[model samples]
Target: MTVMELSNLSVTLRRRDVIRDVSLSVGKGEFIGLIGPNGAGKTTLMRAALGLIPFVGNSSLAAMPLAERAMAVAWMPQQREIAWPVTVETLVMLGRTPHVGALASPTDHDRSQVDAAIRWMGLDDMRQRAATRLSGGEQARVLIARALAQDTPFVMADEPVAGLDPAHQISTMQTFARLAEQGKSSLVSLHDLGLAARHCTRLVLMSEGRLIADGCPAHVLTPERLAEVFGISAWYQDTEQGPVCQPLEVIR
Candidate 1:
């Protein structure tokens, strides 16, 4: 099933085009990595798809009503600001809000899902701790757990592993891969080309507010594409582990 479909999507902010006419679709069981340089409009495209910002053209996910969309897509933005000093469990429980409703109490199943998410993200030991007190990487895991607890068919995360350690980074990507195996779709924006290449089933490359390439990791992460879009040379090889890419040097 096609979980997400965007056509001619465009987002303009401050009288500037942030996301140009872009079209893409995500199917079930696919893990798509949205990769690009900073300010490449990855986040803007996601926000537009979520209907958080005004944009032109069609976004199937954005067309859904608010409550329905909540259950259909779980989004984790780039910012990890936990304003409330809530317990880790409490924060993660918020993911069940779509199912439980705003004022209603969570059912037993909701609580169980939250617990599962906490365990999945390796936060079981800190479930009772204040989320605000955790380190940045720990908090990122907590936030990811919350998204996982949503248990939606489609998950969208912007730079989900930015602050995580190397182990957690690989683990988190593996978690998404497992979700794909379970027939869920994921669209994640990532800066780590190696991890993206290793885990994502496909990649969508964006540059200067436009979609540049969309294909398998080995196809999209070509040295020519890297030098053209990223202005750098990269050393890439298909290792026993998977495709690996390391930026060699800047072209300039």
Candidate 2:
């Protein structure tokens, strides 16, 4: 089943096109890595798909009624800021807001979901800590847990593992992979090509505000494509751990 679809999607900022003529579909149980160089419109495409910005073209998620869309898709933006000093569990419980009406209180199931999300993200120990006091990587994990607690059919994350250690980064990617196994669809923007190659079931490459390639990691992360889109030469090898890609040098 198609969880999200975008057709001819385009976004303009300050009278300049940021994403143009991009079309993509995210299917159920698929983990897609959205990859590109800085300023390659990865974030623009996601914001457009979520209807967070004004854009042209059709976005299925954007067309849904506000409340319905909230249930269908859970989004974690690139910015991770905890302005309030809420406890970790309290922060994660916010994900249940869509399910619980404005005047309604959370049910037992809501609490259970929140607890499970905390454990899933390996944040059980920090559940009682103040969110603002956590490290950047820990905060990122907590935000991901909040998204997981939403229990949406689709998840969209922009640079979700940006500030994590190598181990945490791999663990975070594995979490998304596990979500796919549970029949959730995810579109994650990532700068780490190796992690993207290892964990994502598919890769969508963008360049200069357009979709350049979309396919399995091996097919999309070719040296030629890397050099063309990322301006780098990469050494790629199929390993028991999965496809590994290391940037050898800049093309220029």
Candidate 3:
């Protein structure tokens, strides 16, 4: 099943195209790694798809009513700003608001959801800590756990692993991969080609506001594409540990 679809999507800001004509579909159980250079419009595409920005195109996810969309998809934006001095548990429990209602107290199921999300992000020990007091990387994990607690079928995360430690980064990707196995889909924008290649079931390569390539990890992370789009050379191999890919050097 296609969980999200964007057809001929385009976004303009200041009379310039931030996201040009682009189209893509995210399906059930597929971990889609949205990869591209810094200004490739990956962020704009996700925002436009979520109806958060003005755009010219059709996005099935964007078409849904706001309330319905909130329950259908969970979004973890790149910015990690903890506005409230809430505890880790309180913040994650907020993810259940759509189901529990803002004024209603959490039920057993909501508590369970928050617990699971906290455990997945290795925050069990700090569940009672104030979110604003945590370090940058720890704060990132807390925000991720909040998204996980939402437990939506479709998850869209922008640079979710940006500030995480090496172990947490891999673990976070693994968490998304496990979710995919359970028929959930995740569209994640990542700068770490190695992690994206190893964990994602499919990859979409964006360049200059367009999707330049889409396929399995091997196909999308080809050396030529790396050089052309990323201006770098990378090493890729099929190993017992799985497909390993790393940018070797900036050849351009």
Best by lDDT: 1
Instruction: Pick out the ten consecutive residues of candidate 2 with the lowest summed lDDT.
Output: 243-252
Considering lDDT, where higher is better, how would the candidates rank from best to worst? Answer: 1, 2, 3
Candidate 2 residue lDDT tens string, 56-77:
9999999999999999999999
- Identify the runs in model 1 with alpha carbons over 4 angstroms from their true place: none
**CA shift at 158, candidate 3, in angstroms?**
0.4
Q: Candidate 2 versus the native: TM-score? A: 0.99
* TM-score of each predicted structure versus truth: 0.98, 0.99, 0.98
**Model 3 agreement with the true structure over 85-151: per-residue lDDT tens digits:** 9999999988887888767879999999999999999999999999999999999999889898998
lDDT of 1 by residue, 1-252 (tens): 999999999999999999999999999999999999999999999999999999999999999998999999999999999999999999999999899966789999999999999999999999999999999999999999999999999999999999899999999999999999999999999999989999999999999999999999999999889999999998999989899888889996
lDDT of each: 0.96, 0.95, 0.94
lDDT of 3 at 250: 92
